[model samples]
Each structure stands twice: as structure tokens, then as C-alpha cells.
Target chain A: MTPVSESLRAAAGTQRVPVFRARGVSKVYDMGEVKVHALKAVDLDLFQGELLVLLGASGSGKSTLLNILGGLDVPTSGTVVYRDHDLSAADERELTRYRREHVGFVFQFYNLIPSLTARENVELVTDIARAPMPATQALDLVGLADRMDHFPAQLSGGEQQRVAIARAVAKRPDVLLCDEPTGALDLETGKRVLAVLEQVNREVGTTIAIITHNAAIGALGDRVIRMSSGVIVEHVRNERRASLDEIQW
Target chain B: MRALNRKLLRDAWKHRGQMLSIAAVVSVGIMTVLTMRGAYESLSSSQAQYYRDTRFPDVWVRLERAPESLRGRIAAIPGVSAVNTRVTLVATLDVPSVDVPALGYFVSVTDDRGATLSDLHLSAGRFVSPRRRDEVVVSDKFAIANAFVPGDTLRAVINGRQRDLQIVGTAISPEYTYAVPPGAIYPDDQRFGIVWMHRDALGPAYDMAGAFNEVVLTLSPRADTARVVAQLDRLLEPYGGLGAYTRMDQPSHFILAGELNQVRSMGTMIPAVFLTVAAFLLNIVLGRMIATQRTEVAVLKAFGYSDLEVGRHYLQFALVAVLLGALIGIAMGSWLGQSMVGLYGEFFTFPTLRYEFSWILAVLAVGVSALAAAAGALGAVRRAVALPPAEAMRPEPPTSFRPGVFERLGLGRLLPVAGRLILRNVERTPCAASPRPSASAFRSRSWSSGCSCSTACNT
Candidate 1:
């Protein structure tokens, strides 16, 4: 194990190996007359192969923490170490390298390129990935095998989100960060999208972090962290995680 | 193909309307450039070749009369290579087929039909036979205008005597490529013609048995034409010399050169305006596209595609449009150039006029157009590459809407709801309304200028 994982394991009082260890991370947006503190001195850890949920209401900084963890952003103060890489000190190029090699992200909106078909969307990730599954196989894992030839415009909202998920995981990344992946879908479609995410984590043994405002969806994660105003208010472990079908809004 | 390229192709297809409109504008710009340049090249090359074949004079002088023996002294001037002196006279013609009296410029050819400066390309029949007083060759344009052919007879009153001259041939000369009657700005072939007669016959008829009134000569390469003109004027002054001048002062050559300059300036100015409008349209379209594809850019970056890759994807859209325009422009330009040169053949007679397609010109057109398009696309591509992945995926903040300038000026209450809404919309989306007004203004100005030019041409 690396020194970061060892130290994180000792701090957590458990044998779990952390893929990310962020200490007192903060983010400030300078909106001219006022400074908006999106994230404040919040220390956190994301363990390897564990499905984690970051639950909070709107403006609670849950998405900001997830962004910092995914290397899409850097903290204003404090350090963020992913494995042995110091993401806090990384430049734009180094951060891009980190994202390409290890991190995968899914936004609330599917963000699939409308001009590309489902399979081609997945192939975008596979094209530059060091080691990747075939785009067809990734689509199949997302239950979009039959719709692989369909463009995003032709697919339903939920199906497009599934394609987004397929694109993220095709690279076989070390961790998957999803921010409200089902936020735009209907109840039935949302459940179907969540089941795909659950299946990927269960089958691939990939670490996952999901940020959402829905508290009921917390039962699907191995651990949960509740945030309020830019700081972590509660952190809990679920003894037995519920299946996707059992979770409700 | 890579997925990004596939996306580029499909996105272009989806927006084919805007893309093709931009391409059409680009094509017009390239076509104008190519057409003007091609026509200019055709006129210049044919003029040069005609001048070379005819041994057109470098200097010309006219006087009351100079003894034929003086040709030897004029030829002895420094830098003078070859000289030809002949008696030239103008006479009134009474053609049987024409009601009005025609003007005839009578030039003397050698009795033996030997080569001379300002030679003619024969179109039909033959040159005047040795010492035949009545046999003459007429200009091709005058011959066509009057429907005259070989063996036709026309009466000319030369030096108070009327003589029936028989037409032996018809020809075109480089010296009179843009021939206009004396004191006339435009050619009137029906009222004027050139009549070439044997020197033995024409000299004595004009009371110059062994004398000549006009002199034309060629100069050696690297010779000072001004110095030679000065020296020739001094020698001929005692023989009633009027003046001596080089080809630059020759009316026909001067007019032809001026026309060519017009073509060159048209090639430069018109295309510049067209291309500026094309670039403006491309910038507006691509900017809107990038704005709408904010999330797509974010997703691409978030999925490990580099900023350069994303930027390239958008630039390819512009390249495809420009290439399509270049192909259309090349085809249209070549055809239009051929037609334009053919039109020149009517006014300025050349042995042959051909529009040759230049690969260098085609390459330059494509290069310039691509450069303009890339410049137009630069701002939008930079915006896409600079967007932070995290922030772009989120919805943009709501714009703070307030009363527009018109509303603040107390004009809001006087306007209808629809008019007020439009004002607000224009204020909110300033870019949408910006280029159109300027483009329309430019178009109207171009139209008015074009109308004025056509009216001037008609008069």
C-alpha cells in the first residue's frame, strides 16, 4: 500500500485503503462585491472499491467537494492527495493527466454529444484511455446494447444518462464521481439508471462517489457523508447496503 | 474515423443551412478574386504577345514632311535600332453601301511587302500588291462593320482627287488594338477605317514623292527612350518635326493599360469587402454554436480529451465549409474568366484570347479564405477550450434583466407590448442584432454604387 493509503487507514481506525484523502479543503468564488464560500475547511476520505454517498441540500457544497475530489477543481486552502499525486499543487496539464488516467465523472445532465450515437459516445473515452474495454461492451453493461446505434437525440432522457455512464466507465477508471446522475429523470427511469451504476460498482469493484440532495438514496451506498453550508455535518457507515430496487425518493 | 470527427461531420450536416450560406458567401469572394485576376492575366499576356509578334514601335513622331533620306540620320541616333518612315494621310471615303461619308486613315506599306514595325495579322486575302495604286487592305473591324470583302471597291478623295480603291485584304494591328477615330472617345467602326496602301502610290498622291510625314522606330534593349526621343526631336526639328513620344503616350496602348489597371483594382477591392462579410458571418455563427455546446465541451474535457482536441473539433467545422466554397469558386471563376476574356476580344482585338487556370492562384485563394475563417473561429474556439469542466456542466446563472434604454427614456409606455418585447430581446441578445444591421447597410451602399456604375457605363 502507498503511504497516503497507510496514513488514511490509520486515521480512519480501519484497514480500508483510501483512493483520495482531502484535508481541510476549501473553495471561494470571488463574485466582485462578495465572496461566495462554496466549500470550507472540510477533511474527507474516499476508500477504494467502496460506493460512497455525499448527501446534502442545494447550496450545501456537496457538489463542490465532489469536484475537488475528481480533480476538476482545486481547493482554495488545504491539500488534496489522490493516491500519491498532489492534486492541490497540480497545474492544468497535470490535472488533465490525472483525470485521463484515473478519474471519471458523470454530471446531473447527461452531457452526451447530441451528434454522436451511443456507441460512438462511449468510444470517445476508450479512444484515449490507456487500457479500456470495447465501447460495445461498456454499452452492453449499461443495458444500452440494443440502442448503441441510436443518437442521443433519438434516445430517452434516462437512456442518454445511461450512455453518459457508459462513456465514463469505458476507460475502467479507478474511481467514478457522479453528481446527481438521476436528477433529470422520471422515477422509473431514475431507478433504472441507478441500477446500472450499482451493477458497475458491484461487478468492477470500482470506488464510486455520488453527490445528491436526496437523503433516501443514501441507503444504496456503503458509507454516507452529510454536508451543510460547506462543512461535513455527519459521516456514517451502512452495515448492510440496500439494493437499487429498494431505494425511493 | 474517430468519434470526435464523426461528431463534427454530423453537426455540420445538422446545421447545413448556416454552413452552406457561409460557404456561398466565401465562394462569391473567391470567385470575384479569381475572375478579375484571370481576366487581367489574359489581357496582359495576349497584349504582350501581340506586341512581340508585330515589332510595335517604341517611339512615334509625326511632322509636316521629312525627306526620306533623313531616315538614315534618325536611325544613326544613339539607342535607335530600326526605323520606318512613311507618308500617312487621312481622307474622306464614299462607300457605295454606306449613306454617310466615312473617315479613312491611309498608311503606307512597302512596295515589296517587306517586314516593318507595327505589322498586321492578316485575317483574309493578301497585302497590297507591289506599286498597285488602287489595291488596299482595310482594318478587320471596319470590314466587318461595313460587310466589305476582298475585291470590293470604295471611292476615296485623296488630295483633291477621287480614286476608286479596291480592297485586297483585311487585318488587325497591335498599334491600333483599341482604335478610335480622331477626336472620338469610342470606336465607331462604321464611320472610320484604316486603309493600308503601297508607299510608292500613297507618297506622290500626298505630294511627297521622296518624303515621309510619320516615323516609327524600335530601340535597343537597355536604351534610354527619353534620350533617344530628345535626340530625334532635334534632328527632325529642321524638317518640320511636331514632337516625339514613347509608347506610354500612345493613345491606344495607354487606354488598354488603364483598363487593365481597373481590373487589378477590382480584383483587390471587391474581394476584400466580400471576405470581410464572410468572416463576420462565420464569427457570429460559430460563436452561437460554441455558446450552445457549452456542456458538450465540458463533457469532452471531463472525459480526458485535451483542450487542443476540443479546439480542433470546432475548427474542422470551419475548414469543411471553406473547402466546399473553394471548390465551387474555382469552377465558377474559371468559367466566368473565359467569358470575360471573350468579351474583351470584341473591344480589343487579339489573335487569340485564352483564360488559363493558375494553380498558384487557386492555392492562394484557398489559403486566404482558410486564414480568414480560422481568425473568425478563433474567439469561439478559445471560449470552448477555456471553460472549466465543473462549471460548464452546471447551468449558467440567470441574466439580470432590467429596463432597456428605450424604456428608461420614457418611450416604453408609448410602444405596444410586442414592440417593447422586441426591444428587450434585442438588448438581451445584442450579438444577434449586431452583424445584420451593419451587413444590410454595407449591402445597400454596394447596391447604390453598383447602380451608379452601371448608369455611367450606359451613358
Candidate 2:
């Protein structure tokens, strides 16, 4: 039998640091003749319960950096430390383990399974998590309690996005990575979706990162990181993040 | 894994119409194959029964010369019932309605065994008239083909001479129709037509004055055929122009043997065609299912489900689809098979065309369906198992994008404003969720074929 000594040591090491940290991470993809640099020496961190907005132009690498921080990608050269476990150097199995235990991801498309109802969709994620909130409770937090039985097709576009957020947050994840969570919604629906994310952050204390091309969406975050040409050109901090309802779309 | 299984079940349910069509196809093919085999067997047995009941001559030898004194010697031999020599000739009849070719055989039998050999009831039919002045008995099959009925006036041409005769009645002959060989594969013998007339009918026409042409033999009770044939061959040798044969050397056996081979060949070939199609279809269906679940596969991987676990989930759908299809197919196949056999019974005389349940066939249908469904589902399982959690979680692989080189060639922009823009994007990319797929097409075709083949194996 393998001893648990190292695993015990690693657990203690992970508890001492912030939930996630990235230093000079870069991801360069080889597309035949073009060596596309998707991420360029990006340094980032996510503290507990903080909603960080990642704003950038198209092809500016906001999604790539977010993917790396969520343990969904590996940095080509730099290190990504999730607590003490090195996310970048981890093998496939270890990376899978990291995803299951620590992170929940929401894509721009909402990605709610078309066949499943709102509650069932959230239940699918929660069923696999280490510790998870009830699917009903998660939907209720998103203000979709009454529409839990409706399928994605039956729900409005904004309603579907809320269900996706519920599914992501229901896992009680250490980090929730939203890659343009409201990208497909109109202004009114987009506000409703933002409010759900804000509620999850405030009530469940899950660290969240929202990636988008809209600069105006940044006003609702604790820290705003802007990228251009695959590089982070600006970082701004707000004294107090504006309430999602108070911020104009 | 369990959650994946639930999802897979949902997919099958969503596509139930397609599954049903496939099942219907499989059932039809299986039934056709079963019915064909059944009809062939039935024809063989019925022919055997007709011959046995009537004591039909096991072998009849025909020759040009008449053995002048062979009758007594041949009759004395063991297993020989009676020996009679009669002239046989083919002639045309100048009928009241139509002049047509008719075959006639002259017999000088000591007694009548025509009814015995036919396995029939004497229905308004007299045996050969003692006077033998143009009197004849016709078989049912011969009557139908020639448009003859009871009391119909018929003319027999003997030695190119027309002789008018009264149709005495219709009789059945076991040897007349569907002469089945032992171990026959197909039903219904082709040599199913014959007409019989008495020996006295030819006496005055040829002026032969009591000579004979050939002798037919029926073995004594419990006599061995080979031994009887040897005895008769020796006894008839002195007569100088006679040939003797046992049942094994009969021409009907040869003809029936060939027909049996044809049936066997058909039986072996038809089923294999449907089985191969089923396998190909199953492969396609499985490929599609795996391709569609891009994110779910990654999520399952992240949950630490092993490759086998994921594979098991996908494979479950295949199992359900195949089993359900196969059971429905087998039921429909059997029903259709019986009807097909019934149709054969009309054309071919059968003892009792029974629907026999063959466990081998049932097992074969089930096994084939299962294998096809499993094969189709296999790609998904393998993809899930080999998938790295990180790759699984990442967004799906980008669609195949074709660069607008032609657009850059400058004609695309000048062609039309809106058409060029739409064409440019369409030419460049094909995605999974999009109705027009670059990704899903490859996967869906495999799965659809698999699904369709397994479900429609009969078709």
C-alpha cells in the first residue's frame, strides 16, 4: 500500500495559500504556419468569494487564461499553482481530479443539456461533486425555483443562463469559471444572469471569474483585468464592487 | 457512469421512430428466410406421402425395343409385383376447342393401382373402362393445365393418329406431382404433370397383337431394394432387351436432388446479406452517439469514471435497442414466414407446411442485433476511456474551417454582397450543433447507419 504521508503533506500545503494562483503563464498553439500565442505571460489570482471580471477584445486570450486557471488547459511554459498542487505540470488523471474537486465551468452558450429540465441539469453536476448543494436550492438561488421542471428549450434565453450558473455553483466549487456567461443574452436578461452570479459569490462564498468582450460588464467585479493582443494591458481594482442590480447594463 | 446511462436511454427514446423502422426491416427479412425454408420442406414430405400410399413404381425404365418374352421371367423375380409391356408415344390432339400436343402412354396392366398411388378419393371418377375404347383418367394438376374437367371429350393421338376419348374422371398420383427426394432442401418438384391411359387403348392403332414394351415393379413386403433389383436384372437378361433398376436409380430422385441443391444455396445466401447490412448500420449509430456528447464525456472523465464505466453506459443503449428490435423482429419474421410458406403451398403440393421454431435462427437474430448495436456503441466507450479529463473539459475541437482562398481570389466579393458573405463563412466551417455539420455528419452517419441497420435488418 502507498503511504498517505505525501498526500497529507500536500493537503496541508494547499490550505496555506489562496485558492488559485498563476505566474507568468503563457500558452502558444501551433496552427501549422502560424504559431498563435493564445496567452502571454499572464499573472493572476482568485481569492475566496471574489467575482473577477476578465475583459478583452476578441482573440485577446481572456478565455485561454480562464481555461488555464480552471484546470482545463496547461500553460506552455509557466506554472499554474492551484493552492500547492501545480495545475500546469499535472498529468491527465491529476488534472481530471483537480477539475472534479475544485472547479465548475460555464460556457457562453449556457450549455444546459437540451433534454434535461432546469433542476435535472443542475442535479447532473451536483451528483458528481465532492460536496454539493441540493439542485433545488441552487435553482432557487438563481430565481428559477418556479421553472425547475422546464426544459432548456421551454425556458427563455436568460432563464437558461441562470440554470447554467446554478449547475456551476451547485457544486460548491472552490472556483467557478464563467467564459462569457451572459454573452448570448440581451441587456435585461444579461442583468438577471449577472445578479445570479453575484448571489452565488455573496452567499456560497465561491470565487468566480467571468470572461467577456464587453468592457461595461467589468463594473460589477472586485478586480477588472483587461487584455489586448493576447497580453494583459491593464488591471484595475474597485474599492467596493457595485451591486449587480445597481449597475447599468 | 449511471448518469451517463440515464442520458443514453433518453437518446434512444428520443429516436424511437428510427429504431422502430429498423426493427420492422429486420423482422421482414427474417420471416422471408424462414418461410422459404419451411415451404421447401413441406413440399418434399407431401410428395413422399403421395408416392408411398399409392405404391407408385419406384423406377420406370423406357426404351425403344419391346422385350418379346421378358414379362414372365421378370415377374417371377423377388420384389417384382407385376410386369407389363406397353407402347408409349407422343401425339397431337385435334380438340373441339384447340388443337394441341398431348402425351399418351399405353399400358397392359394385370390390375389397376392408379388410385392407390395417387393418395386421393375417388370423386365421380371411374377407374380405366374395361372396354378401353378411348377412356382416360387425368390428374388434377394435368387437368388444370390443359383446361379439362369431368365429362370433357378429349382426343389422344397415338402413333400420329387421333383417337377420341371420354374423360372418365380425375385421379391423384403421388408420383405425378412434386416427386420429392430424400433429404430435400427446397419444396415442390418441377416434374409435376402426367396423364395415364389403359393398355387396351393402343392395341388396334399399332397392330402389335400382344407384345409388350416395358415392365414396372413393386417390391414384395419387406424386401431389400438392392437385392430385388439384382434378382430382376438377372432374370430379365435372358429376354435380351430389358433394363432393371431399384428406387435409388429413379430419374425423379435425380431431378429432385438438383432442386434441393438450389433451395440449400438460396437458404444460405439470403440471410447473410441482411446480417452484413445490420453490422454496418450498427457501427455508424455508435459513432454518432459518441461524437455528440463532447462535453458530457469530459465531465464524466472529470468525475473519475473509468473508460470501461463510460463505455458500459453507451453500450447499454445498444443492448436495449438491439434486444427490443430483435424480439419484435423475430415475432414478425415468424408470422410473415408462415404466410410466405402458405403462398408456396398453393404452387407446390406440401404434406403440412408447418412453422417450426428454430432456436438456432432465434439465437442468430438476437446475436446479430446485439453484436451490431454493441459495435456501434463501442467507439463512444473507447473515446470516453482514452479521453484525458483536461481535453474533455476543454471546448470541443474547432470545426473544420476552409479558408476563403477563392474569396481572396476577388471573384467571391464581386459575385454578390450578401451571398458572398454567407458563402464565405459556410465554405470555411462546419460545426457539430449546426444543422449542416462538418463534425456531426461523420459521427451521425455511422450511428444512423448502425441504428437503421439494427432496426431495419429485415428490410
Candidate 3:
């Protein structure tokens, strides 16, 4: 068991193991006249029930690495294994299955289907999940239980983002990956959104990884990895993770 | 409902205007298909039923005159079931208030027999009595056109003698259902008519006593109509046969069949054009919509939806519009078809005419429409699914704009800010909407006014 999974077992009162192992993963985008390397031989392990923040500036390959781990993309020349399944060797169908069963993602823009109400959006995932929480329960977890009937257009920015979070977690996947979830929000709204994330991590024991350029947000994570120019520059383990409300941007 | 399906409903409702427009185009195509298909089926069936009920002749021949004794010999020919000999003559009609003389065909009516080939359907009044030599039964269409009913008087110059003929009845006959003036392809009932008179009256009028000018023959069941026609032609050759022809060669049936052929081809051709245009329009609109939803597509993918699921969501949107259009088309076509049948009844004189719905045609229409919509959506759906989630979620790269050669010209410096913006926009994006007004004169005047205003501002 990895250290992060060990910590997750402690949090969940059960034995947990590493969920993802990426080895020397690299991604190259060929632009006809030029080849742009997005990820350069990166290796990483994601365990159960830990909130890991990847901190980087724009063009730092942080988002690309998160995508590879989430099965939304494939590594050009390296292997990524999710539990016992080797992602690099998997076809498109298998990769899609892995994402469906094991991963949830949140984006900078809430990406809630505009036509669907909050509860319906959450129900989208729950309907397809093998074992999922009720759509109502997921909304309650995000503190938007009363607003479940509202459409994304009718809700405020923070409320819509919370609905997106509820939608992502409703499936009760093994891991939750969020990319710049607070990038579009004000300071107060961002803090409230982060607080929800903290609560979900503590309650569900779901291994969570968030990508952001803001260093202040990293204080809420159990581990922080910083990237620059398609490579990791620093990784730090937080001895004590702070509550979101205690930090000021 | 499934969550995805619920999303589809709401999405369609939100864009109801666009959805309805596409559906309207599709409906036009389906409407054309239904109207033509229904008309074709109804007309063909009605014609067959009319021919059968009237016992229409298989062959007809006309000559100067033939003795009545030849009727038995003609009937004795192989496959000949029945024969009728009549005196036929054309006369000039003089109706009141009509300056031009209308042509009238005065046919000799046989004795009142229960079973006679080419029987007339009396629509109004009684048939003329054999004793009343001056009484006549007129074609219903001609009577209707001239506003003449039973007991009306018609003056006809028969064999150089102008005599008053009393109309006793108005009737329709399968032989002359679609009558035309000689040398014309279409009927002009106001200018031409058919009048049936007694044989005793017509025979002396034409100065042909105990003789006939025309013979019509009916063949036995399952007999060859062509072979009988050929034998009749050979037998009557010595007595001025003129020609013996089958029903297919008869002017009324021949012209009607030609028109029906044109309609059938149009049923295929016109709908094809409408459907093709509709499909092309759907493709363009759906492509633009999918392009705008790239980020949403990425988000769906990130939510663990397979590419196929995302594609299916968009396809369902198109199919829903198609189904709605088809239902509207079917309703509209059914109503239009009934109206068309009524119009044809007045023109074709069919005893029974009704719109016939064809299930094969309905199925074909729906199948083609579904195929068209699917084809229209294929390109857009593929693009939506092929997008990489990571790339699609990222903001688009900024577009860089630079000055063009037009901006460097000395005269261009005198242009106003609006003019400069137009020049730069044109340079920045060649495909941008045109800045010029669609009205050509207004576009020239606006350009001149802008130049004058810009020079004044610079001064």
C-alpha cells in the first residue's frame, strides 16, 4: 500500500491501496511544422482518499498530466496503470470504461448541462454508475439540496459549480480530479467551493487531485506538486492540512 | 425518462424555433411525397373500377358505313363476346349567347337494353324515348358548363339541316369521360360536347338507313385483346375498316395515361429536390451548433461519457425534429389528397373517386426522411466525438491581427475610425460578414458619405 492509500484506509476505517501508477509518461502534439511536448517523461502515483493539488502556471503540463490519469487522454510514450489495469495498453473502449467506473472530473467552467436542472445533471452520472448515491443525497452533500430543481442558467456561479461537483461525485468513483475549479470564481465563492471539496474528501475518502495555478489553494491539500515547463519542479507533503476558510488569497 | 433523454427534451425545447424550422423543411418534402403517391393510387384504381363497371369495349372501329348484317359476322370472330353497331356523326352546335360554334358528336343510342356495353350513367333526368326523334341526352360536363339541365333545347346543324334538339338527360360514359375537341389534347367542355340521339332520328339525318358507321367489340374473359383487334381489322378491311384499335389506343385513355405517367415521375423527382435541400440545410445549422458546444462536449467526455454517447445525444436531437415533421406532413398530405381527389372527380367524371392511402409509400417516406436527417448529422456528430477533452476544455488561442497593404496607402489615412475598423476586420478575418449594405445604391452612398465625414473630422 502507498502512503496516501494508508492514510485513506485510516480516514475510511478500511484497508486502501494505490489506485493509479503512471510511469515516464510523455505527450507530444504534432503541429505539422513543429512538435510541441506537453508532458516530458513524468512519473506519478495517486492513492486512495488523499487530496493532491498540482500547482503550476499556464503551459506547465499540469492539466495534461491530470487528463492522462483520468483517461480523457493517452500518454504518447509511457505507461499509466489504474490499479491492476494498464491504461497505456488499453483501447479507446477500455479507457472509456475506466473513466466511467473509476474517475470523476470538475472543470474551471462548471460545465453543467444548461438545459438540465441541478438534480437532473447529477442524475446523469448516477443513472450510468454501477453503484451510485441518490441524486438528492449528492445535492445535499454539496449543500444545494434546496436548489436541486433550479437550472444552471437560474443559479449563481458558485451554486452552478457546486452542482457540477455534486454531478461529479454522484457516481461515487474511486478518484475525483478537478482542474481549476475555482479559477472563475471570486475569493469568497472560491473559498466556499474549496470548503465543499474539503468536506467531500473527509467524508467520502475519495482520492482527490485538484489542478490550479494559485499557490494559496495548495494549503488545503495533503500533498502539493508544482510543475514548470512540462516537468515537476517541487513536491511537498503538508504536515497539517488547513481548513479552506483559514487561508486568504 | 432516462436522464439523457430528459436533457434531449429540454435542449430541443430551448431551441424550439430552430428545431421547428428544420422540421418545416422536412415536412415539405414528406408532403410532396404523400400528395403524389395518394393521387396516383386513387386515380389508377378509380379508372380501373369505372372501366370494369361500364363494360367498356376492348376494340373499336369506324368507317363510312357498313351493313347491320356484318354485326353477326363480327361477333362470330374468335374471342368476340359482344358487339354494338351505331351511327356516329359530328355536327356544329349553336348554343345561345355563345358566338363560336361548339362541336358536338351525335351518337346513335341503342334500344333500352338492361345489359349494354359502354352503358351511360344517367346523372340527371330520363333517357330519351326511341319515338322522340328530336330528344337527346347530353354529356353532364357540357351540360354543366353551359348551365343547361334536363329539358333544355340545343340547336345543331346536322347534315346541313339546323334542327332543334331537346335535351332529356345529362349522363357520363366511360368512353367519353375525358372528351377533347378534335386536334386538342385537353378537354374544353364549353367548346365541345357529346349528344346521344335515337338511331331512327340519326340514321335518316345522316341519310344512312339500315347501315352503321361504327362498331365496338367486347372480348371474352382472358381473351387476347390485340389478337381480336387484328382479326377485326382484317375482316373490315374490304369495307373501309379505317382502323381497329384497342382501348389503350383510344384518345381519352391514351391522354389520361400520359398525364398519369408525368405525375408518377414528379412524385419521385420533386420530393428528391426538397429532401436534398432540407438535408443540406440541417447539416450547416447543426455544424455551427456543434462548433459552439465544443467546451460542453469536452465536459461531457470528462464526465466519463464515451464518444458514442455524446454522438448519440446530438443525433437524437435531429431525429426528434424529423419525427415531428413527418407527423405534420402525414396530416397535411391526407387532407390535401382528399381535396385533390374531389378536384379530379369533377374533371375525370369517375363514378367513384376517393384518396387511397398507401402504407408502402408512407413507410418509404419515413425511411428516407430518417436517412436524410442521419446523413445531415453524421459530420457534426463525428467532429463532436473526435475532439480531445483536454484540448477542447482549454481556451482558444488568441487571434493575431496585423495591418494590411490597404492601411499603408496614403489615401487610406483619411478614412474614419469605422472605416479603418472595417478594413482591419476584413484583413483579420476574410470570412467575416460583409460590411457593405445589401442595397447596392445605399452601399455606394454610404461609402461617399463616410469619406466626406472622415475628411472633415481630420481637418
- Candidate achieving the largest TM-score: 1
Q: What is candidate 3's local distance difference test score?
A: 0.82
TM-score of chain B of 2: 0.61
User: What lDDT score goes with residue B273 in model 2?
Assistant: 65
Count residue pairs with overlapping backbones in model 3: 1
Each prediction's DockQ against the real complex: 0.75, 0.20, 0.69
Winning model by lDDT:
1
> Model 1, A41-76: lDDT tens per residue?
887888888899889999999998988888888899
- The backbone clash count of each candidate, in order, is 0, 24, 1
Candidate 2, which segments miss by more than 4 Å at Cα?
A1-15, A21-24, A43-51, A79-102, A126-134, A186-188, A213-226, A232-242, B1-177, B180-328, B346-352, B369-459
lDDT of 1 at B178: 85
| lDDT at residue B221 of model 1 (Cα atoms) | 100
lDDT of each: 0.85, 0.64, 0.82
Candidate 1, residues B1-459: lDDT per residue as tens digits?
888888889889998998998888888878977899889988999999999888989999999998889999999998998999988999999976678899999999884334599887899999888758789999999999999999999789999999999999999888788889999999989888898988889888999889999999999998999999999999999888889998988988988999999998998788778777777777667776877787888888887788888998898888888988898999998899889988888889888788888888888987898888887777778877898988877765554457999999999999997666556655644554444533433333322322211221222
Model 3 over residues B1-459: C-alpha lDDT tens digits? 878899888878877888898888888778778887778788988888888888888889998788888888999988999898899999999977567999999888877544567888889998889888899999999999998899889999999999999999999888887899888878989879999988888998998779998998788998887788888888888888899988888888886777678767877888788777667656665666666677878877777789989999998878887888889888887778788777877778877789987778877887898788888777777877888887778764444446677877765688886676566545543432244423323333323323222221222
In angstroms, the error of model 3 at A227 is 2.5
Q: What's the best-to-worst order under DockQ? A: 1, 3, 2
